[model samples]
Structure formats: structure tokens, C-alpha cells
Target: MKNRFRLNLFRFVLLLFVCVSCSQEYDKALEDALNLAGENRPELEKVLRHYHGDTLKLEAAKFLIRNMPGHYSFADTTEVKPYYDEVDSVLTTMKGCNVWTIRDSLVKIDNKYADLSPEWVEDIQIIKADFLIQNIDSAFVQWKKGAWARHLDFEQFCEYLLPYKAEELQPLDAWRTYLREFHPDHLDELRYCDQLKNSSLQSAITLNDNLWYYMRPEITEASQVRPIYRLSTRLRMPFGICADFTNMAISVFRSQGIPVALDFTPQWAFRSLGHTWNVVLVNNGKNVPFSGATSNPGQPHKPDERMAKVFRITYAVNPDLKRLSEIEAFVPSAFRYPFFKDVTEEYMDCEDVEIEVGDSLDGRYVYLTVFDNTEWKPVDFALIKGSKVVFRKVGMNSVYLPVCYEAGGQMKAIGHPFLHTYDKEVRPFIPDTSRRVTLRLLRKYPVLRHVQGVVMRLDSGEFHASNDARFREYEMLYRVTDCSVTGREVVLPDTLGAFRYWRYYQPKNGSYCNIADIRFYERATGKQCVGKIIGTDGCWEGNPGHTKDKAFDGDLLTFFDAPVSSGAWTGMDFGKPVDIGRFVFTGRGDGNSIDIGDWYELLYWKEGGWHSAGKRKAETVYLLYEDMPRGALYWLRDLSKGKEERIFSYEDGKQVWW
Candidate 1:
């Protein structure tokens, strides 16, 4: 009987647990699931039946594979991404089947409820490609039939695909010759380059059979001579605009005289969003964009202005990984990316400048910019003798390029306007067992009142951007830890007694946007204090698009600084040097009454509770208190156990009066 009673209690507890785990009662579970099944689901049985016949598929695959690479259909209208809507429709209908096929090739497809990459792709995007007649004779063209390829005739299709007409291809190369300003043919006003712009070296090189070809340029020289049109209200370059600007320029190029192509990339924006851009071969010259066609506020970029960098991309070496670092070169000229330092040749030490084999990157393409060695501008071509790549003879300011491994590690290069973009990426150097790292100031700091910069060396192990695998970008996340000699440490989360942390932005007169972020991490414990700036939805503050003194332009966020004192603990902060060489002032997003000039005292572990460590006396000043509890901004007033005046202060163990 007693055992039966115990079993009854166990069953009751089990039932209670199940009740807590779900929002709905168990009685309604079956009904809800049945309702979900009856929702809007398209009939897919017929679609499955269509593909069941094996003999029918083999015949189709043979024909599709034989003609898939060169098959294409162009749209009658000129809505830039002209194929998006139609492609989306095809994608939606195929949502019923998880697998789709064309001849011998089959792509694993998702349901219509998910996002999909554009279906019909014409990889030969350089120049202008329109399908007047459907033909199977090129690479990157999708195989299309039915009403798709019936629009344009073959002749008109070829003409539209050709981009520039015969009449508009004049007065080119002025930019190419200008890239090689010392070539004796350098025109006085604007620059020009004939061979590099119009002839063989143009990015529109041949690929596949005669009709199949692709160019890497999105903006070439001949196109820049014409008027440039833009529609962004703000002058800053944004992460979203990179690809749009590239494509827009390509469209404009084709309209005038030059032909262009888009370059796909997988790099993140300052806000950590993945992005892309375009590179054009206008006329015969290059047009590198500071900002793309779209508007990306909070980014330091200028789409209309010609960026100093005519071309920038990644490269490979011997198509292998053996001697990838063997090739070394840098910005051929000027203030390219901000805080930039083309450290390629800088880290050189004879043997290090050697490439063995097996190094490559997709972004590792080349650009042929105009050069003026005398004026210290651009050159069409630079030379390389064995391990040394030199600007020899009088040539255009351009050359075949290689990948950049700044700070002595491999990294994907992104846009920046400083001399340093070619060098290795820069980040904080962490210290192994790093007990006393120092905070050094930069050449110039932001003008905001409480803003500061910190360089932390991680302890527990030596810190080098080289060894750390997680160091993806050129910035570090950090949070000052308030721990002790074992027992228990006091942590100043993003919030500490109403004082929040702050972010430092770009210095005045910067040539490019300086986008770098420093965050705190506890190597010992993988707990992130969290994105204080990220929480407030703060903007990535810095110099954007060559414009100066603008803050919170990209995205808006809120950060806090150091403490704002306790009701009673000013004494603990003084005369205490217990070894805190590394510290961070965190910002919080919670609470109020956080007076503008209020300060906080440093606290450390003592006994069981936290006591003032950075103060002189125990009762006078409190090193730390409470701020933002959960997501709500709290105060030392909240940290206190009792009322405002006679509140709780950590004195002698228990919560007692000060």
C-alpha cells in the first residue's frame, strides 16, 4: 500500500513536468497537429508521377547535358535584374519537389517556403547578353525552351550582348596612358591608356569555345569619360550597396561604350552582413568604386567619386597551397584603404618574398590602373624579377596580382581606403598568462568625451592574430573581467552601476573609412558579456566614404562607460594595487538617473561578497554596484538592498547598513 502511494506521487510529478514544458494542454495536442496538416499544401502527387518514367528521363538528360552550358533566353524588358521575378515563379512551382533535374545534372532543391538562388543563370555577363534565338553553344547559359527563348532573333541577341556599338568606341585609352603618366604620351589634363584599355589585355578575355567568353571588369576607363549618375541621399558607402553599385555601373557602361562584369564575393559588411561588389573594364581602363550603387549609410564610402584603387581582388599561386605566400606586392599607389598599410613588401625578408605553389583566392584578380611614377600616382604595369616585384621601366601602373596575408596570416581582402589594405589584417594581440597588458593611445582619438582605445594581450596563453583560428576579421571583442585568486570574481557586465561602455570612431581627415571593432572575451570561460553596442542596435562608428566627423551613420547603438559610484563605498578604491594590469570599461543600456559626470569605484573579491577594491576607505566609495538588471537599466539604487539612503552595501558579509 505504501509503495503504491509513492508511485502515485511520482506520476503526479511527471505529469506536472510535461505541463510546464508546453504552452497548450495535452488534451489539445492531437487536435492542433491535425489542423496544421490541413493548412495550404499544394498537391504534389502528379509532379511525382511526371518524373517516375525512367526511359523519358534518360533521353532528356542526354540532350540537356549536351546543350545546357550554352542555352540562354533573354528578357524583352530592361529591368536590370530582369530575370528575378520569372525565376522566382519557377522556384515557387518546384517547391513541391525536394529534388529537381535537368538532363544528367540534378540539384537538391528546397520547398517553395524557403529562399533560393536565382534559377536561370547566364555566367557570361560581361558585355550585354540577350537571347533573340535559343542556341546551345556557350558556357553559363541556362537551357531554356518553350516560350522562354522565343523572344529575340539571334542577330539582335548578339548585338545586344555585344554592349558597346562601333560609333561610341572612340577616344579610349586616355586613362590607360594616364595610368602610365611617364610613358611620354601622358596627356596634360585627364589620363589615358590605349593598349591596356581597348586591345587584348582588356578583362574581356576568351573562355570556352568562340561564342563563350567572360570579362572581370565592372568599371573601365572609357566609361568614366561620360557622365556618372547616382541616387543615394547620403554620401557614405554602405554594406548593401557594394553589389548594386557594381551592377549599376555595368549597366551604365554598356549603355555608353564600355562593357562590364560583376564580381561575386562572400565577405561581411561592418555590421557583419555578407556582401558583394563589381569590377568593370570600361573602354580599356579600370573604374574601382569607393561605394557601390546602393545607399549604405554608416559606411565610409563615396560611389560617385573615383576611388584611388582602380582594381582590387584576391589571387592564387601555381593553383596549389605550397608556396602561396611566395608572391608579394602592395598598393601600386596613394591612400587606398584607411589605416591602410600595404605591408606586403614591408614584411619582406628576401626568402619570405618567395612563392612555391598552391596558393589561390577567387578575389585574387588583377586591375590595370593608370600610372604616373613622376606624380606618384598610377602605372599600368609593374615588374617582377624572381622574388622581387618592382616598378621597373616606364609602364602603366598595373600588373598581375597575388593574395594578401597581412599580420602574417591568410585573410580575405575587403575594401578600405588606406595605404595598409595590402598588409596583413590588424587585431589586438592576446597574452598567454598575460597579467599586465597596457593600453596605448593612437596617433589621434575620437572627440567624444569618455571614448578610449584599448589593446589587450590575452593571458593563459600567448596571443597572436596568427595562432587564433577564431580571429576572422581585423578586430577583437573584449570585456574587462573582475575576477580574483580563485574564490569568486566580480564581473562588470555591459552594465556596472549605471556606467556604460563606449565605442571609438574614426579620426578626422582620414582618407578612407576606418572600420575596426575591439571586443572583450574570456578565454578561460567562453561567456560573452554580449554585444552592448549590438544590444542598443548601435551603428558601426567610424570614418565612412571619405567623409569625416560623422557618428552612428550605419546603424544606431548605445554603449556605456565605467562606474557611477555606490550609495556608500568610496573608500575601497584607494590604496589597493592587487594586480589589475588589464581592465575594460563596459557600457550598459539599462537604468536612469545616470548623471553625466557620475563615476564608479573598482571592486574586487573579499571574503564571500564583493567589496570595494579601487577605493581608499570601505564606507566612502563603492567600486561597483548594480545597473541594468536583465535588459532593464537599473542603478546603484537598485544594487542597494534597502531604500535609497539607508540601502544595502557589501560590508562584513551580510547585507547591512553602511
Candidate 2:
């Protein structure tokens, strides 16, 4: 009896210790939040007291209050509301119109309101008790009643479904209720189909496919204005960029009890800009990635797409990033917020990269940067330990540079740029001055194999001339047997007679008459001949700018696209017989090829940054750079015009793209 009494006393003491520790922790956190609330402290206190009767709800309220210090919304709604209103008005008026036609008006609207700046207010200072309560109750209903969300624990529920706003600058409104009923029939098919009712992935796929019918992805000048504040405004617009689409998906999915999060790469490993997409958490704890309104779940990215690092956005602060702040280290704007977690291993095979700085420790933080078009941008950060810094779980097969930020945030290179090769080897581009090689560059960017197949459609195409507009009786002018990136000019036979009507007929298996420019030359004066544009009546999607006249518009970037897949033709009519000396035609292309008479500059990467080899004017289809440095990363810039360029390494007389 004495021993039993002693055991009971010990259990009581342990329970008392745990309760006291939890209370102290909660009290400290609440004090810090209330101190930051200032004049809004009473609103927070009201939320806490309202949930005092329910232990679980009280903990939930505390969770939100503790994390509220860094959350914010737009303070000056009056200044920014007009921009959203104007954009929505324009989009509503132009409904069902082609995206190209709506682009100009959107650009004008964005430029008109470019000077408006909205102030930010912290959630701790501006959030109201009623608003917080509504969000919490709505989130709890979905979590308790949602069939697809049964696998989520309390922590996962708080991070993925409980957040009031998906992104910063969002207005504090009742978005959950509005979005829950936004698409009444989006999941009707899923409910009727027995195979899909039990699977969350299939339900997500069905919903995304249905959303694609109403909304599509479009990149325009106005894409810079993202994270549209009003949910109704975003729903009214039919087109949006990747980030806008992802935000919309988050709002819709989370409201219906599907756990979703946004994952992104700061910059693509092989391309110019970054990409954002939605990831739905499944019962197996795996994230299924899909473009919100453009692609379905389980659909893979294009083969050319590459990622060097992927991050998942979270509402909870990252402990690792918070530690960086504790040490007073400089953090880049890409990682300034503590709401992201590195998730590279979930997407691809990755390994830890330990870069040796060789005694040059400029600061406590070292960064890994990727070349983004015109400059090198930091994508990942690590701390210096002695002379080396180790970055964990870095994706492979990309070029990276190690650098440290000095005072004023100027980046200073600490080592030469190196390639994280696919074979898991670090090959640094240390220029060997003793060795040199001549580079014969054909294009600024690598031609994708699929796009090259589109260029090959011109083969076997026939050019004919006839007095009959129907071309029933015609004489063959020329038959193209091969195609080139820079196009070709073929001299017509002198014996060939002139005709009133001339046209190029697409082959049966060819793409929809995808020709960029076509010109006829006079035999007598050798001058270019002009005629009235005539051909297909409608373009792809009835776009005005993609009609038959685009072939004669003198813009290589513009091309004629036919509504029909085959037998569509674009040519000119002289109204009378006229002799043609030569024919020149260019196939539809991305305009990244070397053009005659355009200036270009070749650059190589050294210890510091890109150094120009020399500028030269292209006299032929390709540029020739003599005595260039061997074993280094190279970049070709079009000095005349163009925006798409990529880095490459010359090997075996050909450019190997990253």
C-alpha cells in the first residue's frame, strides 16, 4: 500500500510539470504577439476568450496569433482597388475575345496605373476578431467533414488548409465561403463515377480538366500585376499567368477540403524564367504536381524542362531560416521570408554540394547562383564553415556559381563557375589560355527536337503558277526538297512562263501552312514583286493577326496559321501575268537563329562573370569565332534584338545545352 501511494504521487508530479511547461510557453508567445498588436490587442484577446471553453479551439486560436506577426495585407486598399476594378471592367467587356486582342488593352491599363503604390499592414495590427473567427470556423467544417482530407493531422491541417490568405497583399475577406460555392458542378462527374469517388488524385484531375474549359494560361505584359486581390476579379478574367493560376487553384481547392500547396523553382535550370504550380497532398504523403488550369494531375513536364531546386511555400515559419536571422546574416530577397521549405528531393534526384571557397570568406552567407538571361541570380544560400560551404540536396545537371554578398549586398564571386554534370561530377570551367578552338555557332539557343520536326514539314511542298485561281491547270515553279533555319532563295528557270496566280500548296502531312514570309522576284529587274495577299479565309482560333496576310507582313516573327490541318495555302495574286526571277521563303520559327547583317557578341565565364570575346556581324547563316577559349561556358547575345538566350558548353564541335 505504501509503494502504490508513492507511484501515484510520482505520476501526479510529472503531469503537473508538463502542464506548467505548456502554460509558460503559451503565455510567452501570447505576450509577444499582444505586444506587437499595440492598439489591436483587444481584438486578438476577444478571439482567445471566445474559444476559452473549447480546449482544441483555444489551441487553434493561439496557433494563429503566434504566427501573425509576419503575415500582412494591403493597407491602402483605395489606392489599389481602382486598378483591379479597371482591369476587371475591361476583361468583362472583352469576354470570349481572343487573348491576343485583349493583350493590348490590358497593357494600357497596367501602364496607366504603374505609379500606384499600396502600403502594407501586419495581420497582428489589422486583423479583426470576427474575420479570424469566420476563417477558423469555415476551415474546421471542411477538415471535419471532407472525405479527401481525413488523412491530415492537426499540424498539416493548420499549414495547408487553415491559412486565411494564400499569398501576400490579399485583401481580408470571406474568400473561403465564396470559393466553396464558386464552381457548383465542377465535381459532378467525379461523384457519379465510382472509380473516381474514392481517389483524391482523380477528383483533382477531373476538377482541373473542367477548370481548363473556363480558364486558360496566357502570358502578357500585364502578368507583372499578380496575386489579384479580389477573388471575383480573378474569376472574371479568363486568362492568367502561372502564378495567378496557382493562386486561384489554392483558393478553390483549400475551400473544398482538398489539401494543396504551391511549389516553385526560383529560376529554371535550362530556361530564362521560373515556374509555379500546384501540388495536392495525397493519402500516401506524396505531392502530385499539376499546372492549375492548364494540365491534369500526373501529367509530366516537357522533356526539356529542368529544375535545379524546388521549394514549397508554407504558412509556418522555417526554423532553419529563423536561425540565419539569429546569427545576423544577410539573406537575399528570394529567401527573405521564412515561409518556404526546400523540397528538391521530392521532385528529382539531388545531392549535397560542398563548395570550397579557398579562404575568401566575404561574409557569413554564401550563395549558389544560376544565370538568368542578362544576369546571375542567387537561388540557394548556405553558411560558411571554415573555407567551405555545403548546400544540401541540390538538383543536378545545371551550371552554378559560388558567391558571397559584401556590404550593400553586392555579390562577389568566390570561385569559378562549374557544371553539376548529370554523372554527378563537378566540372569547373577554368579557362585554359594555352589551348584554343574555333567555334562555329549556328544559333543562339538549342533547337528543340520537336520544333525541328515542325520545320521539316516544308519538305516536298510544291510551288505553282496558273492563270486559273483554282490552280486546276498549273505549271510547277519549284519543289522544295530541303529546308534551312535561315531560309533559302531559289532562282527560277528562265524558260518558265509567268502566270496571273501563284501559290505554295502545303503537303498533305504538313503543319497548317506554317510559313513565315514569302516573296517573288521579277526576272527583268531582279526586284522583289508585290501582289494582293490571298489564301485561307480563317486562321487558327480566328485570330486576326494570324491570317493569310501575315505571310506578306515582312515580320519574320509573325506567321500564317490555318484553321485546317492540311492543304491550306498562302500566296500572292498579280492580277496579270508577271515573270518571277527568284523565290524566297522562310519557315515558321522562334526567331532565335542567326540572321544576316545582325550584330552578335560571344561571352565566356571566368572567375568574376561573363567577359566578352568580341562583337561581330553575321555575314552568313552562322557566326565564326576564331581562337576562343577552350573548356568554358559560352553565351551568344543578339546585340540587334531578341530576348531568348541560353548558356552552353562547346564539346566535339557542337554546343551542349544545359
Candidate 3:
């Protein structure tokens, strides 16, 4: 008799859970949900009554109850109250539509139907994608038998109607208007690329191939060219950054009814920068990811870097992500998606990494940081529950440290770096216990601001741009993927010659690599190489104010420029020539159009005239491996009539353009 009584109690509790989970008593839920209707409650009531016996009415009511509170949290409830007619209009049509289709979309729209107040459902984005297309204007082409929907599943189909919004770019409607006006008949052509064999891959490839060359990436001021209005807008100025490319990709894909989302890393684990790209949901049931705007699907230029984390944007509300906003996660309001999916695994190898920290727990968030040359950069973060903080699905083959972002946004490291091996092994590097380890830390200083540059040691003093990597002897040391304002550390080599010369290779992009100093330490003894700036090729080049000599003036603000022609040359005569081991050259940074040589020849004056040291095909701030004799003039001759390049140089122990 006692056992039977216990079982009965358990059954009653279980039944109660089910009822509460489904929004408590149905009548109360229905009544409360209807109350949000205000003046339109009568119309809503009429629609609910029309489908009284059907489950469609209850489902419609549940969606409103689950999401309306969240919508009101941001917007004025009173102001949006009149929108109840729009709500009723959609609900009325649901009676004739497929019930499960609506239910599936609602499940994605709002995860919780029961327990409807902001705990499980703090954020709500009722993606009225279906209603918007089906009921709104008939400008959208028919989905049935159309090229857009023929390859998509039900979920992928919804991504089209769900508008993509990022940053403060132009409204998607304006993008649509431009597409219709300009490329009315090109839709079919934009759906497939001939190179790709897979029909599923065609859509993305087509979008990229059609748009890549058309919207050329020109370097422009960020303030002048944003909220890009249309293809015509880009045509007027034909340039943009990664963000602009992503926006264009979103606009193009969505306009054609393809499923695409913008995914980005807050910060790169290896590089001191961040990037954004597009992921398209193809017919193969897998997302074909690409570096949108700059690269097309399956291209060689696609970003294949190991991203630490990826956050996808969605038009629908994500409940968990929404809660982070309340807890002061510092996530941008635009980033507060209806929902976001972490798809890092799809792009790269990832593992759940846990760092053991012996400290008292606090509500403050702990972060996973990667050593980006000079400082530890926070890439991913999580709340500290106890002494352990776990970073989920981090990419392998990089060094990471556990840290916390303190008040005022200062990042404080909690532990030393541990290498995450490619084979999925976590190995910590303790400084004391090592075999022939790094003897001393070298050059941990900032040299440039938001720049990308290369470091090299002189393989030859010959200044030639050659396709043969060995033609000009500047052995690459390291690549500063993202040079920062605070600077960076130049990782030194294990072994160093007694008299070594190094040069910083700044790319010909529009940013100056303003290096304050260059320091190299003898690996064994820890002795520093005090490099002095000698002179530049500016004295030999054309025009005043823009002569090659400005390159050696020790000022980033000044640069050299010459006419676009072959045989254009610049050189430096190291006074009373010393055995030259290296030449340092900086690209012109004032504008994007300044031509830099792609192919050039390095010549040294030996027998009273310029003699060929070697030929090179590409120009970089290089240290030629071969040591040239003293008293000989060194000059660079452009083989191609492209943009004139800026050149800076240093000899043996002296700086090139101090």
C-alpha cells in the first residue's frame, strides 16, 4: 500500500512537469498571450476562434507567447501593439498551410513554448520569413519549380526569406532593388560555375565568379565608402575590405534565394587581427565555406587559416546568446542574433581544451589567449565555475594561455603557454625544464600599427626581384601577420653569424610599417646588433619631394615615387662602401595605385657600371644573401612598367634610411 502511494505521487509530479513545460494551463497561456494584442485582441480572438479545434491556433498562440516578450524588451510594447494585425494576418493563413512546416520553423524560431517568460526564452526573433514572402508583395519569384528552391531543403529554404543584417550596412531591400534593375536576366548565369563538376557547388562558385572581378577591391578611406548601397555603388569606386566583401556576398547570395551566413572570429589565435567570411548552405547538406568577396568557392585563395572560434550570424533569436548580453559580455548589439551556431569544427580541427587554474571562483569570465608575437590576445572566453575553465572546440597546432579580461578591458594572463599539438595533445612548456631551449627572449617590441610585414636575414646584398626564391638570398625569418600599434616581438633564430644583417619587409599595402627600432641578439651570448640607418636610393631616382631618398629619411610619412615604366631604377651608395650584407626596402604607403615592381633586377656597380648580382621576380623588403664588395653602387631596376615602388636600405651595420 505504501509503494503504490509513492508511485502515484511520482506520476502526478511528472504530469505537472509536462503541463508546466507546455506553458502551464492552456486556457491561462491563451489568455495571457492574447492580452499582448491590446486593441487587436478582438481580431486575434476571431482568428483563434476560426481555428479553435485545430492545433494551428494553439501553435500560433504559443509562438506569440514565447517571443513577444523578447521583442518588447527592445522595442516599445505600446508602439508595436498595433502590429497585432500583422500577427493575426499571418495566423489566419496558417490554417491552410502545412502544420508541421510551421511547427518546424517555430521550433527554430523559439525553442521553448512552455515556461514562456524570459528565463529559457530571454531573446526572441520571430522570423516571419514565410509570411513575408507568401503574403507581402509578389516581387519575389515563385519558389516552386524555380532555380532557387529546386536544390534546397525546407530549412535551407528559410535562410533566403530570413534577411541578413550586419553592422550598419545598406538595407537589403535596396540591394534587391539594384539587383532587379541591373541584372534581371543574369540570375540563371549567377547560379553555376562551369569549372565545378558538382551541381551543388555551382551556386556558390557562380556567385563568386560573377561578382569577384566586377567589384574590384580598391583601398579607400573607411569613412567615405560604407553602407554600400548597391553593385552600382561599388562600381563607382570599386574597392572594399573584408567587411565590405562579406556584405556584398550576403547581399548577392540572399538576393538569389541562396542560404548564406556571415561567420567571423573576434580575434585570430596566431595573427593579431580578425577576419569575416561567408558560409553557404549548399544542396549537399554541408556548408561550403569561402572567404567571400575576395575569393570564390573552391579557389586557391580561400582562407585556410586555423580559426580559433567562429560565430555565425542568424536572423532568428538565440536564447543562450541573448542571455550573455544581460551578463555584460560586451557583444555588439548587431551581433545579438536571434541565434548563432559555432561551426568551427566544419572548417578546422577543434578540441575542448581545459586549463586548470588554482584560484577562487568569481563570476568574471576567463579567456583563452594565444601569443601573437608580443602579447597574449584573448581569442575565446567562458565563465569560471570553479578552479577549472574549459574552452570548447579550440583549433590545434598553436600556443594558448588562460587569461581574464579585467575591468577596463585589460587582459591579464593566468598561466604560461601550452602547445596544442596537431595530433590533439596538450603539452605545456615550462621554462625551467627544457633541452637547448630559447636562450633569451628577443625584440618583443612594436614596430608597426595594423600592418603585415616579413622579416629576413641577408642571404645576398644583391637587390633583385626573382621568381626563383633562391635567386635573391634573403632567408625568411618570420611573418608578422598582423603588426599592432603596441608593436611586436621579432622571434630570433636559434643560431646567428657573428656579423648578421636583418631587414623588415613591409608589403606594398597602404599602411606604413613604422619600425622604431630593430634589435637582434647573439643566440649564445645574448649580444645585441645595433643596426644604423645608412642612406636610400632616393638620390638616384626622379623628381624632388618624391625622390627615392625620402625612403631613407627615417620618416614613415615620406615615400618615393617614379613614372610607370620599365628600366626605372633607384639605389644607394653607402659612403666609402663597406661589405654590404643586407638592403632594407619599405613599400610606398601613401596610396594604393603607387606601382610596386613585380619583376626586377638587382645590380651592383663593380667595373664602373652596374653589374648583375641576380634577377628577382617579386619585390619585398629583402636582405640579399651574397655579400657585395664595398664602394660599389647598388640599384634596383624594374622589369615591368607597373607602379613605382618605395625603397629603403641599410648596409652592413648601418641603417638604410634612418
Candidate 4:
């Protein structure tokens, strides 16, 4: 009995010591924040005193205050508010207008505010006590009452639910209350859904389905405009870019007590521009990604899409990032902010890459970069240790370059470009100049599966001619057997009879008679034939520009996309029966293919940048580059025209797209 009593007493003393230590740490952090608050210290103290009676609320208040020094908002909203107001007005009044017209209007508005500069004010200095109290109370109410939020612990709640704003520079307001009350009717069915009651993912999917009906994503020139900082203004707008939709979704989900976050890739491994989306935290501690108003959770990305690294935006400052900023004088823009956490391993398999840097160039850090069409963009960074640098959790099956940033943000290559193969092998592109090989390139960019599908649709299409306007009686003048990237020409037989009407009838297997330019020639004259455009009453998506006449409009970039997938055809009416000798047709495509008359430049990766192999004018469907460096990453650029090109490697006499 005596031993038991002593053991209990010792346990109690230890527990009390731990609790007191934790409290002192919290108080120290709060003191630091108050010292930095300057004139706003009293407002923060008011919040602390108001929540003193409730232990949980007091802890929550401390969490917000401790991290408030780094959080800031735009100091001046005069120029920005009017911009969002005008955008909201335009989106409201021009609802259902042509997408292009609305985009043009938004672009003009964006330009008007392009010169506006941003000035920032820290949240700790300007935030009010009443606003913080209300925000805390509302957050606690939702966390305790919301069924989908039961799985989240106190840390998750603080990170995802308690934050007042989704991003920096956002206008602070009563967004939680407004969003919670705005669409009470939309989620009524979800409340009654027994299977979805406790499932955060399902609830998020159901809410997204309802929200998508009213909101949409539009990639417009206005996307380049200064961000709309007001959540209410964003809600009022009909459409927005990926980041806009993501921030809006985060507001909505958190308002309903669902733990959500924003995830993004700084740059795609295989293409230009980055992408952002929303993710819901579930019971298993896994995040499921879904595009707001676009796709459901677990939907696979497009086949061509690849991610070299993914990061999750967080409300708290990352300690590692803060350390990096302190040690390095200049950090790349991608890592300049301390509000992101790397979550690449959660999305795909990753590998740790260690490269030897013979010369560090007097730099302390090196970055792993991926090609972004026009240039190599840094996706992840590492510290230079001794003669080597180690990049952790890198995505596989992509090409990467190691570079060091010099003064004024200039990147200097420190290591050779290498491919991290899917089988977990690293192969450097050393450029074996001792041997040379010839390359026959088909296109600047790889023909993706979808593009190939469009090309294959031209097969089996039949050309018919008849006197009847309805083509009730017709003769099959010619049949298309194959099509190429440039196009195909079919020579009609000499015995073919003339007809007043001629049309290229689409095959049932074809995808909506998707044809670009088509031309017909008169027999024995070698002269192009012209007539009234006929067939296909409506175009896809009701776009007037894609009407049937576009097939004969002599523009390869535009095509006649039929509203229906079958029985759609476009052709010319001769107005009189005239013998047709041949016809030329091109398929709808991305126009990255080598054109017969276009000029192209072939380059290879060497040392730190691209070195020109040669330039040639394509005389055929493909370009031929002779005596090129073997075992090197190649890029074929269409100097004549194009904006889409990718880096590729030649293996076994074929171009392997990275």
C-alpha cells in the first residue's frame, strides 16, 4: 500500500510538470506575437481574456495569435475592390453570353488594373478582437456539430478549419457565416444521406455536384489580372480560374466543417503551366484530390498529365522553409513562401536523387528543375553538402536538371541533365559525340492518344456525288483509306461521272465528322472547284465559328465539329454537274506536326542549356536531321510557327517522349 501511494504521487507530479511546461511555451509564443503587434496588442489581449474561461477556446485563440505575425493582408483595397466589383457586374450582366465575348470584356477590365501595386499590412497589427472572437466561436460550433469532421484531431482542426482566410492578401470579412448560410438548401439531402453522413469524401462530392451547377471554371485572359481578394466577390462571379475556384471551394468546405486543403504542382513535368485543386481529408489521414466544379474525387488525371512534385498549402509557417530562408540569401520564387508542405509521396511513387556537383559556383543550394515547354522550371530544391546535393521524394519517369541560382535570379547549370526512369534508374544525357545518328522526327510535340483518335476518324469516309440535293441517289466517287498528319489526297477515277452535289459523308465510326480544310478539283483542268457550302445544320457547343462552312474555309486551324457524332457531313454544291478529278482533306489536330513548307530547328541538351544541332525547311511530312549527337535529350522546334514543344530522347531509332 505504501509503494502504490508513492508511485501515484510521482506520476501526478510528472504530469503536472509537463502541463506547466507546455503552458509556459504557449505563453512565450503569445508574448512574442503581442510584442510584434505594436498598437494592436490590446485587441489581441481582448480575445485572450474573452476565451479565458474555456480551456479549448483559449488554446485555439493562442494558436491563431502565435502564428499571426507572418499573416498579412493588402494594406490598400481602394483600387482592388473596384476591380472585383466591375468583374462581378460584368459576369452578372453578361451571363449566358458567348464565352469569348465575356473573356474579352474581362481582359479589358484586367488591363485597366494592371498597373496597380500591392501594399501589405500584418494581420496581428490590424485584426480586431470581435472579429477574431466570432471566427473562433463559429469554427468550434462547426467542428463539434459537423458529422464529417469527427475524424479530425485538434491539430487537423487548427490547420484546416480554424483559419479565417484561405490565402494571403484576402479581404477579411464574415465569409464563414455568409458561405454557411448562402446555400443551406443545396446540402439538405446530404444531411439525410445515411451512407454519406460520416464520410467526408462523399459529402464533399455531393456538395461539389450541387455547387458545379451554379459555378464553373473559365480560363480567360483575366486570369492574369490581380487576384480578387474578396470571397464574396469571387462567389458572385460566374466563372474563375483553377486557383480562384480552389480558394472558393476551400471557403465553402471549411464553412460546412469539412477539413479541406489546397494542393498544387509548381510545374507539370510534361507541359507548361501549373495546376491547383482541392483535397478533402478523410479518416485514413489521406487526402483525395478533386477539381472544384470539374471532376470528382479519385478521377485519374489525363493520360498526358504528369506531376514531378506536389505541395499542399498550409496556414502555419513551415519551420524547414523558414530555416532555408534564413540560411540562403536568395531563394527561388517557388520556395520563397513558407506556407507550403511537400505532399508528393501521397500522390505518386517517389525516389531520392543524389547528384554530384563538381563545382558549386559558390552557392549553398541546388534546385531540381523540370522542362516547361519554353524553359526549365525549378520544382524542388536541396542543400549543397560537400561535393553533392540530395533531392528527396522526387517523382520518377521524368527528365530533371540540377541548377544553382546566381545573383539577380540567373540559373547556372551545375550538373548534367538526367532522366529518372520509372524503373528507378538515373541516366545522364552526356551527349556521346563520338557517334552520330540520323533522326526522322514526325512532330514537335508527341501525338497524344486523343489527337491520334481524331486522325483515325478520317478513315473509311466516303466521297459521294449526285444530282439530287438530298443525295437520294449517289455514286461513291472515292474512299479514304488512310490519313497522315499533313493530310491526304485521293485521285478520282477518269470514268467518274459529274454531279451537281458532292459531299464527303462521315462514317459511323468517325467522331462527329471532325474535318478541317477540304478542297475539290475539276477533272482535266487541275483547277479547284467552289460552290455553296451545305450539310450539318449546327456546330458543337453552338459555336458559330465551327459551322459546316469551316471545312471549306481554307483554314487548317478550324474544323466543322458536328453537334452529333453520326450522319454529319459537309461539302460543296457545284450548282451544275462537273466532273471532279481529286480532293484534298486535312484532319482536326493541334498543328504541331511538321508541315511541308514550315521551317524547323533541332536542338540537343549540352552542358547547361540547349545547343542547336541544325535548322531545316521541311520538304515532306517529317524533318530529317543528319549526324546528330547520340544519347542526348532532343527538342524539335517549329521555327515557322507553334507554341507547344516537348523534350524527347531517341532510343532504338524512335523518339521517346518524356
Model 2 regions lying over 4 Å from their true place: 1-30, 98-103, 106-112, 186-198, 216-227, 302-304, 325-330, 448-450, 460-508, 511-586
Tens-place lDDT per residue, model 3, 1-658, is 9999999999999998998876666566467545655554565555445446756333543433333333322122333223333333443555445544433443432333223232121212322333323211221242333454445644444444333233232322345445534333444654365433234356666666666655445433232321333343333233445766775667666655556678877666544556777777666677666765567666543355556777776544465555655675454333344456677787787999887776664555676765443345666667766777777898887666676654455555676556677888877544232222111111112233233332221111123222222224544555544332221234343342222333343343322332322333434554433444322323223556655445455343355443322222233322221233223333333221112233455544332223576665532223232454433323444455422222112235432210
* lDDT per residue as tens, model 2, 86-180: 98888889988888677678778888987877789898999999999888887887777765676778888887888888887777888888887
Best by lDDT: 4
Model 2 worst lDDT run, 10 consecutive residues: 219-228
Higher-TM-score candidate of 1 and 3: 3
Per-candidate TM-scores read 0.24, 0.81, 0.53, 0.83
Candidate models: Cα lDDT each:
0.24, 0.81, 0.46, 0.83
Model 4 scores a TM of 0.83
Candidate 4, 533: how far from true, in Å?
Answer: 12
Q: Which stretches of candidate 3 lie over 4 Å from their true place?
A: 1-143, 164-178, 182-185, 189-200, 219-237, 301-304, 326-338, 362-365, 370-378, 383-386, 404-414, 428-658
lDDT of 4 by residue, 33-69 (tens): 9999999999999999998899999989999999887
lDDT sort, best first: 4, 2, 3, 1
